[model samples]
Target: MEVTPRRAGMVALLALLPVLAFGIFRTWWAGAITLINVLIIAVSLYLLMSPTEEEAHEAHADNGVENASDEAL
Candidate 1:
């Protein structure tokens, strides 16, 4: 459920690819569409690749609970 620093870095790099491509090869409208496409792709990739909510909850439940309780204090 936890994202390693290396994996986070890789995802960040992948998300920036569209911007880089746009800067290198497109005009205004094309760049805008490409940027939107990139965001969709990044979100899709994250959703597809990330662990399920149950898994994340199980992995971080203790920390999550503590944080929630702290917020109410």
Candidate 2:
């Protein structure tokens, strides 16, 4: 499992969405904040489904350890 750079970037943006919305709501307007929240949620869903590099590395490491253990046994 690995996330493309684009997907990672999108995930980061989604994670920051709530903070951006709060700032906008406080200083500028509510409607813009609401729209931003909706967009963030949608993007977040996509990011949540995307595979990450950490997951891939962990999986590879797990498999390697398992193979090593089997060989020792």
Candidate 3:
């Protein structure tokens, strides 16, 4: 799914939850888990938010290649 502003906000909240829980509960392990989760969420957000123009162009280019090869057959 594309990262709309709402979704991005939700992800930010999700990343924050673990840290908050760790802080409130004094759980070191939770802190580690939170760090890992934040990294994963950050990457997912980046991918979801970035434009897909290159991928779209590549898909169209691949289809053209396939159609040209089919015509030659």
lDDT of 3 by residue, 1-73 (tens): 6557456746665767768778578878778777777867777776677658997777777843457557889
lDDT tens per residue, model 2, 1-73: 6776566657656646676667666765664666577667757766777668898877777843456557888
Question: Which pairs clash in the backbone of model 2?
Answer: none
Q: Where does candidate 1 clash, by residue pair?
A: none
Q: 1 or 3: which has the higher TM-score?
A: 1
Q: What's the TM-score of every candidate structure? A: 0.48, 0.35, 0.43
- Over 16-52, each residue of candidate 1 has an lDDT whose tens digit, in order, gives 6768678578776777777777777666666666778
Taking all chains together, the TM-score of candidate 2 against the true structure is 0.35
Which ranges in model 3 have alpha carbons more than 4 Å from their true place?
Answer: 1-14, 53-73
The candidates, ranked best first by TM-score, are 1, 3, 2
For each candidate, what is the lDDT?
A: 0.69, 0.67, 0.71
